[model samples]
Target chain A: MRVLLAAAVVVTLITADLHFNKLSTARSLLDAAATPLYWLADLPARLGDWSEAQVQTRASLLEENERLHRESLVLQGRSLQMASLQAENVRLRALLNSSALVRDDVLVAELVGVSPDPARHQLLLNKGASDEVFVGQPLIDADGLLGQVVQVSASTSRALLITDATHSVPVQVNRNGVRAIAEGTGALGTLEIHHVAATTDIAVGDLLVTSGLGGRFPVGYPVAVVSEVERDPGQPFARIAARPSAALDRSRHVLLVFIADAQPKE
Target chain B: MDDSGYGYPVVLLTFLFAAVLAILPLPQWLMWGRPEWVALVLIYWVIALPQRVGIATALLLGIGLDVLEGAVLGQNAFSLTVVALLALVLYQRVRVYGLAQQAAIVFVLVGINQLICQWVQNLQGVGARSALFLLPAVSSALLWPVVLHLLRGLRRYYQVS
Candidate 1:
């Protein structure tokens, strides 16, 4: 009788969670309550980081600082050009009467934990709704687009990586602006572009970027680079695969993008 | 059964430790081999004290795990309730068995737990493509004796009756 009661409760909870948004508040509250568990679980990694910092050689640190200083000099030179280019682009947009583009703001969040299940490509970030991190917010790393926030609690949020089996992003080829949807293939390094015509201009080595059609991700962020293209006379659509630009498995810090127009109106 | 409930705190602490281990980050290759820590801990408690730890305790722990994993609220709850029921029914016979035989039973129990979780994930269309999801069951079975000894020591130390 107790087993049946527990089973019934499980069925009801699963149904409510799957079919309705009513459980989201409860879920967030649970996440908030479990915050300390995540912190405790992350203790080993934090200790490792602390020990590494403590054990780093002075000469090596100096060498790294020198390299960063040189890199920053080059980046500063580029930013000067970017400032003029941005002003020129704004003027061009005004002449064309197109809506002005607003710069996206980002908040850096450290990875607190990873999804324990290997099948799920999700990340737990230190930022949450309290940090104004909301569901559907796009995440990026230094190299390219990473993922999007899927769940937010008080001080922690979960983001689904673009390489997750269920995730898909709208992208365009940088070479020609041809649009395609890049679907995650459940592998960290690979994404599949489905339903492309065999005659399409896509080829191996084409750069895929966000097209901004979905309104979920900001425009023109690097997503992936085509790695393979297979065409067969018998099949109507070509098979294409790309490598994700972001270091999905390696990045320790990710940026949550806040676009001016992408905020939830609620 | 101990009506004083003096052992409940110790039981809760063990579960909390298992929860911590369950979410500890592991390298990519080791992820599939990560043992089902919470399930093993729940099984231990159920076997140790059937009266104090049963389906209700399993259900609550499973919900906590679901929250920790950001899974659908009841996914682990369903699987763990079934595990608790099986453990409760078999604990009498299991108490007299050798460690090897107990480990075998644990393999079966954790395997069933993995299957239920996989089934739930499959319904949501995010299930693993390979049978590697069952690898945790094997790892959990291999670690059963160690966990059993350590937890037994802790239980005896606390005089958990």
Candidate 2:
């Protein structure tokens, strides 16, 4: 009888999680209790990182500093052009009477942990609710779009990668502005664009960027590049696949993009 | 030896360390073989001290694991509660078994945990892979003797109730 009661309680809990948001606060609190365990688990890797930094030779550090300086100078030069382009874009938007796009601020976060289950592609970030991170906050790397925040605790958050099978991003072809949705295939190396008309303008090698149609991600961030396109004469839709632009497998640091109006609904 | 207050805290610390091991990041290739450390440790406690570590304790720790893994809530809790109940029922027979025999039982328990998790995940629309998901149960059973011996040594050394 007691075993049956416990099973009932478990079923109740699962149903609550599926159908309502009532358990989120409780989950956050439980996650906070488990934070120290994750930190302890990460100790060996953190020690290795610390030792690697400490053992770096001064000459190597000087060489890295010089390289970084040159890279920063080039980036600054590009930023000068970007400033003028932004002003022009504002003017164009005003001429067309469309709302000017708001700039997104970013917060740098460290990868503290990862989801244990192999079926899910998620990374836990060091920054969480205390850092003002909320669910649906977009994450990016130096290269391109990465993913979005799915759950937040007090000092950590879980971000689901674009490679997760359940995740999809709205994207458009940079070549001809043909919009489609890129859906993750659960495998790290690919995402598929489904339901495209056989005659759609999409082709191999076209760059896919965020369309911002769903108001979830900022517009024009590179998402993927079309790797394969198959159009069958008898089929109504083309089968398309693309490679995600971000180094989803290798990036250690990620940026949380804070857009004013893209806050996910509670 | 006595029912002192130190007993509960020691158990908690052991479980805490197990939780840490369970979530530690591994290289991609080794992830499937990572043992379910929390489940193994919980099994140890339920078998060793069934009166103290019961269904409620398993449920609580399982929920903590669910929160830690970011899995659907109650998945681990359900599996663990069942495991604890089974351990409770079979504690007398399990106590008399040789190490190898006990490990076979551990295999079944961990396999049940994995099976329940896989079922819940499928219900939530996650795609199923092949039987590779059951790898943890095999790994956990292989490590059961080592975990049992180490934890037993600790219990004796510390004189935990």
Number of the predicted model whose lDDT against the real structure is largest: 1
Any residue pairs clashing in model 2, and if so which? none
Q: What does candidate 2's lDDT look like per residue over B1-161, in tens digits?
A: 55643457778989988988988989888988889999899899888888788899989888888888888899899888988888998888999999999999999999998999888887776644678889999999999999999888887777666
lDDT for position A91 in model 2: 100
Interface RMSD of each: 0.8, 1.3
User: Tens-digit lDDT track for model 1 on A145-181?
Assistant: 9999888899998899999998999999999999999
Per-model TM-score versus the true fold: 0.97, 0.93
Backbone clashes (count) for model 1: 0
lDDT of 1 by residue, B42-120 (tens): 9999999998899999999999999999887899999999999999999999999999999999999999999999998
In angstroms, the error of model 2 at A119 is 1.3
Query: Model 1 reaches what TM-score against the true structure?
Result: 0.97
How displaced is residue B67 in candidate 2, in Å?
Answer: 0.7
